[model samples]
Target: MAKIILNRENLFHNLNLISKQAKGIEKVAIVLKDNAYGHGLLEIAKLASEYGIKKAVVRTHEEALKINNFFEDVLILADVENSTYSHTFHIAVNSLEQIKKLPINTKVHLKIDSGMHRNGINKKQLKEAIIGICEQNLKFTGLFTHYRCADELSTDFYWQRSNFEQIKQEVKSTCEKLSIPTPKFHSANSSALFRVKDFDEDFARVGIATYGYLETDTIFNNPKLKPVMSFWAQKISTREIKKGQRIGYGGSYFAKKDMTVSTYDVGYGDGFLRLNEKHKYITPKGYKILGRVSMDNLSINSQDEEVCIFDDVRQLAKIHDTITYEIITTLNPNIKKEII
Candidate 1:
């Protein structure tokens, strides 16, 4: 079976960098959505907690419940529960309608669609949202907005930041007029946090950077972060292929000369990307993958009992024309993860 190994030292190193950029560890909220981006929720949560992290961000209330014991604050990005509110859980109010659905006395962070216009309420609806939050008896604790292209070299980031600043001021004034406590403001993710020279936020909702993959453009002087996860697979069987013999489903690969090959127990079925023979994928150790990747295995020219599928996914993501987030998050959660 394929397995995942997490580097504890690398994780701590990344967190240290994030903490420095965030101005302090207290200002960092590790994003644990989608099973810690498929690095194993419980596994990463334990490590984060051990590293003195106090806050976490997840996609659902259900995910928060699993790691509540690991953090002082758990922010649910997109789910609300009717159950009694706990100080440990804070839901993000994406819409006025969502505010109405939240239980009375539930703590929430208002998400403003400053410019991304994806989730969150529009900036124009600020007063309406405040009124709803007050009327609904929800506790407004924070306000945040997502950047659309903070990683790219574009002026859009500045444009969005300017918009969020306006929204923040409006929120503060409206809260003051309504006699509501001033809510904390945060507008940076991993990329945006690094883009700015000054780090001033209640919390930076850091995701990929915490796991050691910064996606900023090379033109920017991005910090060098170490990858925390490595994937490995065990050899299931081995055989010798004679010269001129074909291999795999469509016979897309044939040995020019005799060579020893082994099928490794890792494939798309286990959330790994399947490669066709035309691409000629090779392992980090320089062993060539011999044929089309199978549903449960792939033949590689190696006899080692265990082979490293990837220690870092950036190159693999480039080969597949996808992002590192997709590459890591697509990994099957069922795979065992060990912190080294």
Candidate 2:
């Protein structure tokens, strides 16, 4: 059977690195949405609690409920509907309509659309959103924005930051005028937390970096992060095939010469992909996957008793032409997760 091995030491190292990067910030909210980036929610939540992390971010009320007791605050980045759970979670108000719908006195983080245009109220609607939050008696706890190009080498980040700065000033001034206490402001995400020197905000909401999947050249060049998860599977069977013998569905691969192949207990159903011949995946020891990945099994050109699928998701992301977050989060949560 295939299983995930989590290195607690490596996770601690990455958390420590994040703390160092967030030295000047008032708080560091670990983004645990997507099941802690597929590292296991309860497990990583326990670790974060033990590490003295006081804040966390999730995508839904259910996710926040799972780890609500672990942190002083759990901010829900999405699903801002009024519900019984609204009182327990700090909801993110991404639009003026959402602000109006929130229950009275519900805690919220005002999301200003600096430039992402994916979420948050537009800059033009900032005043209306703030007024709605105030009129509805919602407790404005924080103000924030998302960066669309913080991971890339582009000037768009600067423009977004400038717009957020303007939003910050407006939020503060408007709160003061309405006799409401100013909320804490934050904008830097995982990439901006490291790349932006002016990230002296109330908190840094870090996600990918905590899970060891940084994508920026600036962070990668420094190399302080360590991947925490390693995937492995045991060889279930082995066989030798003659030259020209076809393998797997569609005869996608043929044995060039008499060679050994071992079947392992992991496949696309386990969150792995059936790569085509042109993008054959390799094992840690450089043995190639022989053919199409089955739902619950895959064949590899190796006879080892066990095999390491991957220790870092970046390699898998590269082959899949996607991001590391997608690769790691796709890992089936049903697989056994062992913390070492």
The best candidate by TM-score is: 1
Candidate 1 wrong stretches, greater than 4 Å: none
Assess candidate 1 and give its lDDT.
0.90
lDDT of candidate 2 over 193-302, digit per residue (tens) = 88865457889999998888788866334547899899998899999989999989998888889998889999999888667667767777788888888889989888
If scored against the real structure, what TM-score would every candidate get? 0.98, 0.94
Q: Give the Å error, residue 338, model 2.
A: 0.7
lDDT of 1 by residue, 114-167 (tens): 888799999778899999988988898999999999999999999999998888
Worst 10 residues of 2 by lDDT: 215-224
